[model samples]
Target: MYKKSLVFLFLVFTVCHGDIFEECEDVESESFVSSWQSCQSYVYCDGDESMLGECDEGQYFDPETSSCDDAANVKCFLDEVDEPSVEEEPEPEPTPPVMEQPTDVEIVNTAPVVKPNCPNSDDPSQVIFMANNASCADYYLCYHGHAIEMHCTNQLHFNGLTGQCDYPENVHCPLDEPSAHKCLPHITDFFPHPDKCSYFYYCIKGFLTLQQCPFYYGWDIERRSCVQLNVAKCYGNSRRA
Candidate 1:
């Protein structure tokens, strides 16, 4: 009996801390856990509609939903700090509240908008939620009307001018070291593919792999991360290396 208890503890530790994760049909899978994510995780927020997805190289999270239209889109903005270019986002349509919520998590709309701001300049008055912010790495929300400063996974910062998090070339951040983003959500494992937006990733047993839908197809959230959505008519030859 004591030996069985030890094995159970080990399994719990691995599931909670191990980097392994597999794709599932829904949040009901045995692997489902709140806030779980993989080693390389990225996310986008559409007015509380925060979901994990990939972004283009060098580009930071932009509130411009158009910029984040699909996984395959690319972006790379370079600008200075202090001169923020956070654009105002239009009011989004009312949708169901987010599935995951902590007791202390502050509501964006209810929170006062008077940000000093997140690593990336959010709507100067509102919180701009990104999967990866340079400071307040995780579980940070409005601190007295000011969006909490986000930190890079390990080494990064939000450039006010470019409106993204990246290396410190001209941006007003440390110029010596660099960092990467890590999994923050309870459900940490799979996310959109970083390089090939058409693809998403699956992490299991400390291993990660990129996955994509069948030919000329795209990911349909209502369906499967990998499915034949047949949106190729809108985008010719939707295949990329």
Candidate 2:
């Protein structure tokens, strides 16, 4: 029985070796032997479960697909890794022109110059002195609140003695009586006279003397003087009448 069992075991082993060689023979290359199973020595699951089959040189087997795809190929794509390109913005345009502002120094305020009341006073535009008795015809003009001196060109007669520039009222003498030719003594009229101006000049009824008188007095024609209160002479002539 020992001898018969030994012979049967040897025959079974030889048949198994022959089957493995025939099955793996279809894999032509000598390097294809690795595709065969070690224990049974047969084609591994018909190339599907082979240990080494159709494997990439540098890649390992991928169990999910049962293939040898690249390790780097599984990573994100180049397009995904790179960020999207940003658009460039356009520049703004310039604004229109504007007018310049005016300066404060350009504007000026001025007061009108005062004028004389007389129609044809030496200078019609020249201003005259102001007094309490100033009339519309002989309106008084002021300069810095003070009365200004004026020529007697507007008066018909002048009283030298009393320094009045208006006509005398109800004189005792006749109109034809020639009066003394005289001028007023007021410092504002006589002392400070113009160097070349005519102090006396002929007028309508008598002569006009460049002089001044106080508001209360009038000219005394017969005496050639100004009278205070229209009655008495306030100033005397150089020559006694």
Clash statistics: count for each candidate: 25, 3
lDDT of 2 at 74: 30
| TM-score, model 1 to reference | 0.22
Q: Name the lDDT value of residue 73 in candidate 1.
A: 37
* Candidate with maximal TM-score: 1
lDDT of each: 0.35, 0.31
Give the TM-score comparing model 2 with the true structure, all chains together.
0.14
Error of 2 at 9 (Å): 99
User: Best candidate per lDDT, number?
Assistant: 1
Model 2 Cα lDDT, one tens digit per residue, 10-108: 232222222334334465432223221111111222343332233333332233332334544432122233323333244453332343454653432
> Which pairs of residues have clashing backbones in candidate 2?
129-148, 161-225, 162-226
Candidate 2 lDDT: 0.31
What are the per-residue Cα lDDT tens digits for candidate 1 across 1-241?
0112212222223212322233222333322222222212233222223344432333232333322222223232322213223343555643433344446755444433222333543343455433323222222344333333344443344454444455545554321122221334433455444434356566565565667654334543222244433321112223332
RMSD of 1: 22.4
lDDT (Cα, 0-100) at 27 in candidate 2? 57
